[model samples]
Target: MTGASGNVGRQVVEQLVAAGEPVRALSRDPARTEWPDGVETVAGDLVGGVPTEAFNGVRALHLFPAPEGVDAVVAAAVAAGVVHVTVLSSLSASWETDSPLQRRHTVVERAVEGSGLGWTHLRPGMFMTNTLAWAPAVRAGEPVRAPFGDSVAAPVHEADIAAVAVAALLDPARHAGAVHELSGPEALSQRDRVRVLGEVLGREVRFEEQSRAEARADLLRNPWMNEQLADSLLAMQERTVGVRDGLVLPAVDEVLDRPGRSFAEWVADHREAFTGPV
Candidate 1:
């Protein structure tokens, strides 16, 4: 699977291995990637064009929305006789307003859909792992500071996302030509999520609301973030607060035949990241 080392992709790889499937995991740097026994690791990048061997004898593929070389990647998959593909897209793609984030995934989606191959789109909402950004504050026993403390989102577990992807990959007839909008079982505000984290870690974590200016300044200071993206994200959060933007969907339960995991479950599973060394 392409993007096998990524957050959701790593779970996909592991679960696929646990199911006794032969997985060909693609990575930009194969030397640094650790794979389960009997799994093949390939050195490849979506932007650089995936190595042809990675597609050889592969029937189904899991793809990430890397727009730059998406056409080439799909072409290679088709040439190698790949029949089905499950793409990791975002909920932004379904938004009414246009955005760079949405456009990037839309471009890749169009290419894959136009490729004449069976395709399933996995469009997930905010990920539970996004809360990891507060790890440092929690570890230091500091209040988590951010704007829109009451903004709610049904943050999905990375494992659940991967499970849905793997299901689609393994059963094309049931999932092909489908779009799955996955989210967590329940919606929680930012502060509510922090409380859940504290509950799971057996500690008290406080929340501090940051003014728009403070949040903007903090976001701008991050070298990895920029003004446009920051402004867009903040705008979204503003819209979500005291709204129904966090509506939990039934796609996960319908597709996987089980309830989607909750934020508390995710925190319990990842408690170490907040509590430090065991």
Candidate 2:
């Protein structure tokens, strides 16, 4: 599995391990991460060429979207006798916009679809983990400041995304050629999510809304972010403001035969992130 140490990929690796499947995990630094007893950790870089030996004796592949060499990786997997591939994709891929964020995942999706191998595209909506960025302010006992505080999204749990990917990898026949649009069980505005966090942590968490420019300035604090990417992110959130609550999809529930985790549940699970050491 590629990106075996990542958010969703780590969980995918864990779930596969729990299922007694022999997992060959590809990581840039294999020794940094401790894996379960049977997982074979290998050093490979997706941005650079993924080592061919990583695919040897492998059948189904769990793929992560790397900006470069995606087609080469897929081709290597195909050549190594991989019959099925589950791609980690974004909901933005289905968007009508022409932003790089949308095009990035769509390019990977198109490559996998045209590969003739059995494929499943897991197009998950906003990840609840994205809110972890607010942890520093929350721990500092300050309000979480971001633009589009009123923007609504059905932020999905990373576990659900990994679970769907695991199901597809394990039962390729049942999930092949499927495109799943996943979301949380309910829609919640960014403000509402802060309220949920407050309730879960038993303290009044606060949210301070910023203008688009302010948010862009804040995002630029990251040296990796440029003007265009920051604007695209803000624009994406701006587009979601006031979106209907019922727009939440049921793919997560249908695929797992259970309702997706709620934002409140996510907050409860991550309460410690908002509140530091007691």
Candidate 3:
């Protein structure tokens, strides 16, 4: 699977391995990637042409959006005789906005759809793992600062996304041509999310709202971020405030035959990250 070391991909690899399925994990630096026994690690980058051998004997692939080399990756997959592909896309692809984030995933989705391969698209909303950004502040017992404390989001567990991906990859005929919109079981405001974290950690975590100007200035200070992307993110957060940003969909239940997990469950599962030694 490409992007096997990513948040969702890592869970996918783990779940696939737990099911006794042979997995070939692709990494830009294979030497640094640690995998369980019986899993193969290959050195490759999606943007730099995935090695053809990585596709050998592989019936299906879990693909992450890499627009730069997506066409080549699909071509190579077809040439290597891969019959099915499950792509990890985002809800942004379906958004009306024409931002770079949306365009990037949409391009990859279109390429895969037209690649003459049986494909399933996993379009997940905001990930629960995004809350990890508050780790440093939480560790220091500081109130989480953000521009929108009441912005509602259905932050899906990465495991749920991976679960759906694995289901599609294992049974192409069952999930072929499916576009799954995955989300958490419930919607929670940003403040509610912080409360959940506090509940799980057995601490009193607080939420502090930052003005738009303050948030913009703080974001622009980071070299890895730019004004456009920062503005886009803040705009999204603004739009979500007092709105139902999380749309609980039936796709996860339909595919997994169970309801999607709640954000509280996710926090419980990841409590160590919040409460463990810093």
Once fitted onto the true fold, the runs of candidate 1 whose alpha carbons sit more than 4 angstroms away are 220-224
lDDT of 2 by residue, 1-278 (tens): 99999989999999999998999999999999988889998898988878888899999998898767898998998899999999999988878868878877888888988888889999998899998998998899899898898899899999999999999999999998999999998888899888888888888889999998899998999997888878888988898899965659989999999999888888787888877752
Q: Estimate, for each residue in 119-149, the C-alpha lDDT of model 3 and write its tens digit.
A: 9999998999999888888988889998888
Clashing pairs in 3: none
The 0-to-1 C-alpha lDDT of every candidate, in the order given, reads: 0.90, 0.89, 0.89
Error of 1 at 273 (Å): 0.6
Backbone clash tally (model 2): 0
Off by over 4 Å in 2: none
74-122: candidate 1 lDDT, tens digit per residue: 9999999999999999988899998767887899999999999999999
- The TM-score of candidate 3 is 0.95
Candidate 2 residue pairs in clash (backbone atoms < 3 Å): none
Error of 1 at 121 (Å): 0.3
lDDT of 1: 0.90
Candidate 1 lands at a TM-score of: 0.95
Worst 10 residues of 3 by lDDT: 243-252
